[model samples]
Target chain A: AQRVTQPEKLLSVFKGAPVELKCNYSYSGSPELFWYVQYSRQRLQLLLRHISRESIKGFTADLNKGETSFHLKKPFAQEEDSAMYYCALRASGAGSYQLTFGKGTKLSVIP
Target chain B: DTAVSQTPKYLVTQMGNDKSIKCEQNLGHDTMYWYKQDSKKFLKIMFSYNNKELIINETVPNRFSPKSPDKAHLNLHINSLELGDSAVYFCASSPMVGGGGGDMDTQYFGPGTRLTVL
Candidate 1:
């Protein structure tokens, strides 16, 4: 059974403060993780993927295989960054095509 | 232009009625998918089509049917809808998996259709 868990349903942070949205997954194969964001009244969009190893909009997430985690982090939180974030995982072997998404975390960067 | 788009951003209807939500993608991607997001904000994949072929089908009710006439279009039709079906339905697309690094495949989502069953 593959599952993605985002423990925090709501995370509030002050502007310029550091932010970390935790995510964990349960899977038996290699993991391809991603962080997606949905801003207010906007469509859900891709923020970043672990495989890209790149930062998007000052947010970065690293795939921790040992911990089975892919936590999204940002040194400085911006008000515009407040949105619903989802952590997803994809299997590597035979079932690598479909994505399993977490319940999602709502990050509120209060000014 | 939007890569993925869905019609009827807001739909309000009664139970026992049938409805259809249309989706189209202009990214020329080979894979398209339908997802359901409940009020609790839990998103789950309902169906997936790649190059006009059904590749992934989650445990969805028979009343919820998806139709994809081509690689660029995938529509969902619900028959005798129930109140429990009220939720946000999202359509997404992505390039074919595997080939140029499967991990690089990123799905682009539509604005989503909010179905309100009364």
Candidate 2:
């Protein structure tokens, strides 16, 4: 079965500190990975995707096939960056349009 | 303008009652989906529709039904709602590229409907 694991329920870091939110996946075939974020009182939105390999909102995630991970990282954390982040995977096969999402990790940037 | 919207931003109802949540997308996407977020904030896909056709249905209970009257609308109806059904439901839509079953498209989500069953 394909699954996305976010491991950390909450991650706290001081402002200007580096931040890393761990994400791992279990899948046999190639998977399309994505990071979605939901800020307080804001709707959920796409942050980035492995296919695009683009950084968004100062956050970058590199797909590590060897480790089967796509951890989200930022050089410096900001108070405004605090939000709920979710790792999702879409398997490559028929009837695989649906995304399997992780439990999500809440990042709290302490001022 | 709202790209994707869901009706009844908050719903508080008694158990055993039936209710419906409606979703609409003006982005002209070919696919729409329903996701449930539990109290723990764990999100899971419940159903998906492509161009008014059912494409994916997860292990949701039969009491829950998803209806796509058209490509731009998808509605979820729950029968005899249980206390366990209390959660935030989100509606999302994505454009299908290359007609490849919308595998690699970016999904836009609505504000979400918080359902509270007592």
Candidate 3:
């Protein structure tokens, strides 16, 4: 069984400060990692995927195969960045439609 | 326009009561999913349907059943709800399930329906 772990349940960062949300996964085969963000009273939306390797809204994440982690990073946190961030993993090939998600990290950007 | 949407923004029912939640996707995607977010904010997939066919069924209890009338709709029905079943249910859809690349697994989610079992 694949499991995703988000070490920080709640993370506080001052506005303009760098923010890092840690995520680690336990899987045997290769897996696809994704970062999803849910704003206040908003639906969950895809932020970025490790496979895309594209930065969105000044946020980027790199897949670390060695550490079995994919941490979301932002150079400067903004008030709009305060939301619930969830790290998700999808197994490759068959039954890959199912996404196993982390408990999620609540990011609080203090002004 | 709303890409994915679920009916009954909030549901409050007593234990042992039966309830149903409906979901629809206007994105014309082929795959739809049902996920439950518990009180601790732990999101887990309960069911997945592609073209009205059952594909991914998690270890969820039999009390939870998903019905897909067509490619764009997937409804979830709970036979006997329990307090533990109180959670936010989200509906999502993706263009394709398995293949690789080109937004293969990029999912569009609904606003979610909060179910509270008293």
Candidates 1 and 2 compared by lDDT, better number: 2
User: lDDT of each structure?
Assistant: 0.91, 0.92, 0.94
- In order, what is each prediction's RMSD in angstroms? 1.3, 1.7, 1.0
The list of candidate 1 runs beyond 4 A from truth reads B99-104
Question: Candidate 2: fnat, from 0 to 1?
Answer: 0.69
Q: How many backbone clashes does candidate 2 have?
A: 0
Error of 1 at B58 (Å): 0.8
Error of 1 at B113 (Å): 0.2
DockQ of each: 0.66, 0.62, 0.79
Q: What lDDT tens digits, residue by residue, belong to model 1 across residues B1-118?
A: 8579999899999999999999999999999999999999899999999899888899999999999999999999999999999999999999876434443478889999999999
Interface RMSD of each candidate, angstroms, one decimal: 1.9, 3.0, 1.3
Question: CA lDDT of B74 in candidate 2?
Answer: 98
Better structure of 2 and 3 per DockQ: 3
Worst 10 residues of 1 chain B by lDDT: B96-105
Model 3 residue runs over 4 Å out of place are none
lDDT string for model 1 (A6-95, tens) is 999999999999999999999987778889899988888889988889989999999999999999999999999999999988777654
